[model samples]
Target: MAELQGFVFPRTATGRSSILPAPPWHYSGDLLTIEYRTDPERVIELLPDPIEPADDPGAVALVWADWQSCSDTFDELLDPVRAQYKEVFFVVRGRYQGEHVSRCVYIWVDKDYALVRGHYQGYPKKLGSIHLTRPVAYGKAGPRLEPGGRFGATLAAYDRRLAEARFTITGTADQGGFVNSHAMLHTRFLPAIEGAQAPPSLHELVTMKTVDVDAGPVYVGDADLTLFDVPGEEFGRLAPREMIGAYYRQVGATFVGGTTVHSYDD
Candidate 1:
């Protein structure tokens, strides 16, 4: 008799790895974005040295997305739940190594596979309840992607509402803000289990540029944002002082590789 095992991961498992498969992972999704302005000091507090605030440091973008993702290998899409998930992420404007950049400071996803994949790619992803009002075109009841279309989204953790926003579409554009503006920089830190944990087992500042990028017709809108102060959480500190605008769009990309600008293990 022959033994069975996963090809790349879960060396001890008898079958396919419950974790994510090998990349490049493909993603197709609809997203709602809320762009806002906070304060420079708030943005500064989240960043490390050498990666300073941008010219408009307070500019931030929050996104709520519904995604269907698959790896290079899957069971012919027969299992849909394994490929569906929702995520909300927060991004801020910054300059990395003298170039304008966007850095993801916080992200919350609803699936373990998505979280684990993000960790490997340097995104600080955690689990949360993310609810987005997806537009439906079947009947004339739910929101539609036409003029005056209204949609809302929320993020909650520890049974507390952390963020909220509403958007009403007015027109169309060709692009999105920080979420699609530049190469996203991330801090990949895997702390050591023993000793002061000063030097992590792996500490890196990596950049992400997904291939096969496609931006759908962007719907522009006016937006309102409200952030709540949750106990033991600092998400409220970056509260929006002014609403920039709102947008809804469909975006597609493939994640394969990341470039590390700095490695702190030395």
Candidate 2:
């Protein structure tokens, strides 16, 4: 598998802010038991049908994407991709109010999906024979993952800075600050894969429908992704709307991102 790549936001005055928070999949009991690839086709299918602008000038645009975590299956998915591709990249971004920010996560891997199961499971799988489950939304700390070496180190640095900012006297210390960053990451990956195919027209994609799939809560474990680091391979790219359209087909999703062609209507 590729090395885990992410951003490390500067610490806020309070000491509680991180660009990479505990993703929803960590505590949601989401089984990291699915496989994915940079399939432009599948990304299109996941998007919602574009809606006509409401007469009211305040209607927000809608979009959809999937999320998973580091599980046994994730290792399965990475085994093959690790051998096939020299590097695996995860892209993310978000829009809030009137501004947008994005980032890229790049890793080194030769093959793709040699160890993963089929399809990306965005939600928690229902267990017919399971006993109890924990649905703990992160508290002030945000979220936690079983940290490894390299990837874990990066996350730790980010988490420490975030914590410092959160506790700063002048800062709000609320998880709100990181919200936009995380949202940007989630949204950023969408375009990464979305543009991989035909590359959506500038205006076509930034303004489509989004559906939030019902993902039941899940619990996740930690895996060591530091051993697979490739210096030049770990990176990120942020683009403007105009430039964004240009990259649609240039870079697709990572082998773990997802597969399956989709359209706004699908």
C-alpha RMSD of each candidate structure in angstroms: 2.5, 19.1
Reference-based TM-score of each model = 0.92, 0.21
**Clashing residue pairs in candidate 1, if any?**
none
Instruction: Evaluate model 2: give its lDDT.
Output: 0.22
lDDT of 1 by residue, 12-127 (tens): 34656647676788899999988888887998899876688898888888889999898867552568888989999888878887898888888999988889888988788989
Model 1, position 75, has a per-residue lDDT of 54
| Candidate 2 structure quality by residue, lDDT tens digits, 1-266 | 44343322434554334233222222111212101122233233333333211122121111111123232234423643222212122333333333443222222122223111111122111111111111224753332322211111121121121100001111111221121123222211123445657553322222211223333322222222221222322211111111111000011122223222224433
Off by over 4 Å in 2: 1-208, 220-227, 236-266
lDDT per prediction? 0.83, 0.22
lDDT of 1 at 248: 94
* Candidate 2 to native Cα RMSD, angstroms: 19.1
Error of 1 at 59 (Å): 0.5
